[model samples]
Target: MKTFSNRLYSDYLMPSRMTTHEDLIRAAQVAGYTQTSVRDFVATLRGGRDPQHKVLIHRHDIDTDLRTARKLFDLEKKYHIQSSFYFRLSTMDIRLMREIEEYGSEASYHYEELATFAKRNKIKDRADIQRRMPEIRDEFVRNFEWIEQRLGRKLTTVASHGDFANRQLKLNNTEVLADQALRARCGIECETYDQILTDHTDIYISDRPPPQYYHPVTPIDALRRHRRIYLLTHPRQCETNWSANTKDNLHRFYEGLTW
Candidate 1:
C-alpha cells in the first residue's frame, strides 16, 4: 500500500500541479473520469442512456466554506465542467447559490435534519428517536420547503450529510426522508452515497481524506477502471496548496465548535 508520505512527495514532484488546474482537467481529458454534474447524470438516466458509459459525477458538499465553493465554481467554469453543489441550510446564501447555478451547476440540499434535531432536543435514546420519526420528517419538510422557496424551484434531489457522531445512536438523517409520502410531498429525490453505489454500480472517490491517506480507489485508479464514478469533493480539498487547505479547515472546524 502507498503511504501518505509517498503520495505527498509524488504530488509535490508532479508538474501538472502548476498550471491551469491541469491535474483535475487531465483526470477528465486523459484519465477518463469524463467530468459530469449530478443534473446531467439524472438527465441521462431520464433519457435512457446506456448506464455502462464511463460517467463521472462531480459532487461537492459545501459544509461550511462558501468562499472556497465559489473558487471551485470558477475553476469548474474555466474548464467548462458542471457539478452539483450541496449546501447545508445553515450555510445557504441566495446570491452564491444563484451564481453557482448560473455557472451551469446544480444546487441541492445537504440535509442533516434528524441529527440536528436530535442534538437540539437532547434526544439520545433509540426508542425516543423511533417515536419522533414523524416529527423528524416534519422538520425535514419544513427545511426542504424553505430551501426550495429560496432556490425558486422545486428541488429535484438531496444528499444526506453524514453525521458520524450521531451514528452510534442509530439516528440517520436520511431515514427521516425514507417515507415515500414525505419524499413525494417534498417533490425531491434523495441520493446518499450508499444509494449512488446501489443505483449506478459506480466507483466512489473522495478527496475528503487527505491526499496522503489511501482510498479504496484513487481517482487515477477509478479512471483506469473505466467504471461509472461518483466523485465527491469538498471545495477546500482542491485548493492548490494542500497543506494550507488542511490548516484552514482545522481552523474553521475549531471556530465552528466555539461559534
Candidate 2:
C-alpha cells in the first residue's frame, strides 16, 4: 500500500483545492446543498412539499473502497446531515450497510443488472441485450430481493450504475427501470442524474472531475438562480491527501479483488 500510494502521489498531479470533509461542511453551512436524503426528496415530491424551497440531495455512489465510504458516512453524521448511499453488489458489506442505515442515511442498490447479465450470458451485442428486456428485468428483481433480504429492510429507491464502456452501443443501464411493471414488481423506485435535473430546478454538482478541474456553480450563482441543488459524489473520489482520479480508483478496485 505504501508503494502504491507513493507511485500515485509522484506520478499524478494533485489538485490544490480538493473537496475535503471541511468543504462539505462549509457547503452545508451556506445552504449550497441543502441537507436531504434521496428518500426524503422523493417523499417531499409525493407529499407536495414546496417546490420552490431550497433543498439539497446528497448522493454517494460507492463504486469501490468501503473504508473511504465509512469515512464519508462519519463526516456526514458529524454534521447532522443525511444522505443516500448506493452500493454495488461487489462492494456490499452487510455490516457496513446496516451501520450507515442506523446512522439515518438511506441505502439502496447501485444496480448494473443489464450489464452484469449480459456479461454473464456472454451476450456482447447491445441489441441482443435490449431485445431481452424481460430477462434483464427479472435479473433486476432477483438482485433487489437478494439485497433487501440481506439488509433486512425494504428498499424504496435505486440508482443505475453507469457502464461507460457500453455507451458506444447506446446502452444505458437505467433502461431497466423504464419498465414500470418491473419497478412495481421489485418494490423499488429508480433515480437517475438525468431525472433529477429534469424534475427539479436545482444546481447539479458532481465530484467526478479532479478538484482543480471541478468548478461547480459559485455560491453566488447558486443563491441567485437556483436554491435547490443535487450533489453526486463517489466515495472513491472523496479521499483526503490523495488524487482521486480514474487510475487511483482503478488501483483500489483491483487491490480489492480478494474482497
lDDT against the true structure, per candidate, is 0.69, 0.71
Q: Stretches of candidate 2 above 4 Å error? A: 1-19, 194-197, 211-225, 240-259
Lowest lDDT block of 10, candidate 1:
11-20
Error of 2 at 97 (Å): 1.3
lDDT of 1 at 222: 68
lDDT of 1 by residue, 1-259 (tens): 5666644544343232223334655676665456777767876765777567577788888876576677777777877877889998766877888877776788889998777777667777878888988988888888889887887866777888876435757766778777889878887654555464447746677664354422576666767775787777764444434554456457546634642
Enumerate residue pairs that collide in model 2: none
TM-score on alpha carbons, each prediction: 0.80, 0.80
TM-score, candidate 2, is 0.80
Per-residue CA lDDT of model 2 for 1-259, tens digit only, reads: 8667654653354433324545755665676556778887877776777567677677888877677788778877877888898999877888988987888889889998877776556676878888998888888888889999999988988888876434644787888888778778877654655464446745677664443223476433455566776777776555533433555567546533422
Query: Who wins the TM-score comparison?
Result: 2
